[model samples]
Target: MSTNAYRGALLGIVAALLLANPAYVGLVMDEPRERSPTGYTATAITPTNASDQRTVVNRVGEEEVLTVAQLEDANEYSPYGPRYRAPERAAESLRAAVESGTARTTGEGVTFTLRRVGANYRYLRTHADDSDAARYHRFDVVRTNGSTVVTTTRVNRSTVAQYLVYKDARLYTALPEYQRETVDEVIAADEYGYRPYNDEFHEVTESVVVKNGTYYVFTTGVHVDDFGPSTKTVVSLLLAALGTLALVTSIGFTLRATRERRDG
Candidate 1:
């Protein structure tokens, strides 16, 4: 009818189109879905009859990343640290093998085990490379000059004892005679659905919890979220109410404008 009425109608149509657009609807009307519950709360840890002094040697996974310095510092020295083959011991072993008629005649491809494999420091004297020193304990059995084979160093000593080992964002603690419990269900419920499985990453705390003098360790980065089922439902209802109000107000405006035009 009038220019003002036509302009108002055009704006209403544009607004309605924008609100009903499929892309807009898809973006804003995403069906609320469940999110992975991760992380842990302090309350999740409790006391139990399970002994705290539990010893777990292979608790660390193979995928865990460790620097050379970290590995070496884990104990007295790195497990993969440098090792040395003593020249005197090597010669003696070869001599003994020859006396026993086990030595090769050509002095090539001779292989024998020497009990006196020197420490990492001995290898450091000859090798200038820092990497070579880092791998002093682990030796490679290699073939050299066609027939000669090089063997790794060896020792008759038992494995070292370590109570704590932390690498690659993971910490393992082995204590004796302590008792503790892990309440995952309680934690999940209380913390609003964050549940961490065994050995999974948890970001809630840097220090492991010790329950009643017992020790517990959490692995990986854990996160806690405020959004859950109740939150989703409230948001959805609020959006629906706003949308209904917008629609009703637009219809009222149109009707009132048309009535005014007819009266005029």
Candidate 2:
């Protein structure tokens, strides 16, 4: 074979291998898979009158209210306190609650009113902790009936809230301020797990939200793969670029050789 022919063949082989890098990477790559929690379900309590004012009454008589600083100090020494096993964000939330005087009970026999806090919309599988293994959150809805106030709390899989949370986390930085606010408003208004939009990327096997006067519905089902670009992807892209260059060079050599043969 002529020198040009040999060079062209070598280049062609290199091009083919490089061009196939992406396919190879796709096959062997370990993509981050996120499946809906097992046994996803929800439970609800009977509705009460909306007019019934709910207060954080300590059921176990009066107890000493500990400050957030004190709790942290205690955790530093004991490390097995109530906040020890809690996620950092959850612990922070507890601290905030204590500081605000909303939650001030500790020790045995302590009981306090339960209120549904805002949802954590930026929840990601990568950010999951041991607590995520069996996650749940509550939502309360109140209605007024004549001179009575009715309220009900519904408990559902955190996966339900995570759908929107994932979206918000993914798009928060990219969206405009007004758009961000719009998203926040939507989340705030639909606190009872309503409007579980069908995400195109994630496969939502099951999703439903039932909230009305008589009954409340809870839905859960979604799988989110971590889409962040991996090292394999970056390498594949680089290989693709090299492959294109090699292929083009091979074509150039083949064309030159053909011209030489024709001239001879």
Candidate 3:
């Protein structure tokens, strides 16, 4: 009935609500500036008619969202195309990959959209000791393909030559120099294994642009380094632990105060 009691009750309710949903407290940190320019760029890849595979000419702001297939056709039968995959990487890491100076890009005009290029190991298992047994390659993709590449790492550490059981070869790719370094490191990871790593990463790309009537979006996410939505999960958990501690401390102090007032 007292004003103090009412105030305590109100504080308790407010704290409960905040602890329940982090978004309510604006606990979800958004990094619009940190997002990749190329992420979520393809806004209109919907097939215009269900009867045909044809896509509609939908505009996402100033840019037109065309599928990789459509762009390839416009240029030629270029093997390089767009793809959509899970998880996103940081621009810094992307830059590092390119800086390693191993990536090479090769494709005639249209098919030349290999955002990533790397090697595959067919006989990697037999030659586990040899990181240079897999054949190096790079992919060139073009419009509307909706391509997504996932790079993973394993603690066990193996090479493409080991996983695919390919004959003697080394890790390599064709892209901007640094980009190739990224591919080489990932393909050389121990955890990336039989399954793709892209499925588990969080996306943080800010914007995507197709300049000169065509563009390429390249990205790679590394474990314990760059995380996506899953990273949010980790944050949420840590906050919850703090919330629990707060609740306990608040209750303990409240009870102590009550006892001292009664004794006085």
Candidate 4:
């Protein structure tokens, strides 16, 4: 009875902590029709000032180097600059191409294909070595249709693990609405697969369709990825620290209560 009571209390504490977390907790149902039966098309987003952006593909789990485009100028290369082409513009072009069946995404043994997904402003981070880098967040997709499940670790702006399993449209149609919805959210979160069930990160991950109008708020200095999960090492260390603190505090209190009982 004592052990049961302690376990219950511990769970209660965990629930309260998670409830206090700002990131909203979402529940997944069994509806499988949430996935959209849409095909993708590739659009060459070339800049007036062509620069080199390498498109890497891993086929059959074997890394393959595709043709890399060279950029001669940054002025008109990507609208958002060579760093980023702006999310809205890229999203618009890609969506249109796929809808028209102009952008047919294909490749065998290809687990991940990162076409020049529209480049977005990713804070150009600098290293301590005085080196400079212009990094941008890209929007990429993993093709799947029922029998061909493509699951990716979403790394957007959030604190959850998003596992997207894409298959044939025919297979997607058979999924229950809720199940499909869950899968869509997972893909949207992209890389959120790093942490799927954490509720205290203040990062709400809503699995969504690529076309869905979901965006993340940005903060200056350190733009926390509001889309994907954090590194596993960092997350695990945080949990361990919290666990140790909780255990110490609980033991201290129990010992104090036992001492009082003896004294009385």
Candidate 5:
């Protein structure tokens, strides 16, 4: 009945409505939601289409989007490509194994050992230790003045009075590293199996670029969703609603107290 009550009710409704939809509030308040750029100078890979096998274009001034096969083709492939471990580290392991005379076995009982007298020698299990001895094979590490090589034989035999040196034969690769937060955000925004199903709804929030021959990373989130709102969306809305209710209740109590004072 009082002006205070009317104003309180109006304020409560307006606040509740604004709190219910943050996106709407941002739009009305002219607040842009674009993310900040990563200081690293590198391009980002962005999807260009809504296809299941979406094409992606490099954000570094490249407008052309490559197909799934095209992207795969662009990726370098090597039989001895860089892995998660360094090749030098693997070589160190080999040296340790040789010095210890006990090769590291992969629980299959297949042993790899190295020995160095005046000459270096390496041995690989042709089969399990419990297998037939006759079927076993031994390898000789031979080093010439020019080059080093490994020769396999059915049995250990005398060489041509040459020097034998163990050559590290393990393949190694450098592990790929990226911005963890960017990678996680992109993966979270993506559909299962990195599909493009969520592309129309979700998008990259921030682009994280790493230069100097390193992996580029980016962050993504669902800005708009045609399907039912995500759990995050629901929780955000609930929090906003609670906050609005609390503020509105406080304002109403304050106004009511003021009205009582004026009437007194």
Candidate 6:
């Protein structure tokens, strides 16, 4: 009836419209849904010589025999350190050994020689523009008795897409069709989701594979978030709640003013 009453009515109408907006309503009702595969298969093979000593031959025609721990320490936060150089030299030696039809052995009885593949390094260098290009390592497990060969097994490891090879067929087959499809697609393309974060790119997918009874796990260096309420949804719900409260208060004020005028 009065100017204040009319303004209250208008306020109530504006608030009601806001509360009824599809975007606001949708935000309030939004529920979390599955985004990606949450479960992962475990590795099938366990290494028996993890603690064994490894002899590394440097580029200077000198032998630098270091244990696994020492090798790790040499490369810790040091880019061009011994650990980094070791792989390149090891790959060269491996190539030489392979060409000469000889087995490169280290440690005691059963020797396991692990080295980065020279081809992968060259590929990465040639395709420097390709972000999906990854490095690979070659692992050879050899058994010898008094200079006589017994058995040997070789396994290839990819630094990026480790899950490319599923050693256990039954485990892979047990996965749901959708998951299997995703894994297969990632492996086939040799590419994983790379998202930009703070001026840097990060990998979002993780994978694992087992070969020759050895387990290898690798990820895109980014952790995938679980299903939860998104930031936008939370903000929408908050704004909608405020709008509803404003509508209710405006309606109450208008009704109270009308009753007062009638009593006057």
**Which one is best on TM-score?**
6
- What residue runs in model 1 are displaced by over 4 Å at the alpha carbon? 1-55, 61-215, 219-240, 260-264
Candidate 6 overall lDDT versus native: 0.39
| lDDT tens digits by residue: candidate 5, 1-264 | 566666666677766665767656444444233333221221232222222011111121121111112222222443575322232332333343334432332311111111121132233322222223312224443344433333434432111000110011111122123233433344444332122322231223222233333333332222333355555566567768776886678597668968786887
Q: Which 10 successive residues of model 6 have the least lDDT summed?
A: 52-61
Residues 1-264 of candidate 3 have per-residue lDDT tens digits of 444444455556655654675674345564333322211112211122221111111111112121222322333443574232210222222222234522222223212233322121111011212233312222222234343232222212222212221221122332344434333343344432111223321121111222233222213332233446555566667767766765665565566557666876
**What lDDT tens digits, residue by residue, belong to model 1 across residues 1-264?**
765556557656655664555445556656645434564433322223222211111122112212223322233343774332234334443333323423222232123222222112111111222232222222322334543232334211111001222222222232221112233342334434334443323332343444445344444235555554464455655555665566666666677778888899
TM-score computed on alpha carbons, candidate 6: 0.31
Give the per-residue lDDT of model 6 (tens digit) for 1-264: 787688788878888776766555665566544444322222223323221100001110011112223332334657664435454333334444434444454533122224332212111111112123312223233334633221222222232122222321234454456544544443343234322222111111222333243443323423366566676567667767877887888888898888889898
Q: Would you list the clashing residue pairs of candidate 5?
A: 82-173, 83-173, 83-174, 120-164
Q: How do all the candidates rank in terms of lDDT, highest first? A: 6, 2, 1, 5, 3, 4
TM-score of 2: 0.30
For model 2, residues 175-263, the per-residue Cα lDDT tens digits are 44543443343334432322223232122212112233222112332233345667777878899999999999999888888888888
Which is the winner by lDDT between candidate 1 and candidate 6? Answer: 6
Off by over 4 Å in 3: 1-14, 22-229
Tell me the tens digit of each residue's lDDT in model 4 across 169-240.
123344456544434444444332222222322211211122223212111112233434434434544555
lDDT of 2 at 17: 97
Global lDDT of each candidate: 0.36, 0.38, 0.31, 0.29, 0.34, 0.39
Q: What is candidate 3's TM-score against the reference? A: 0.23
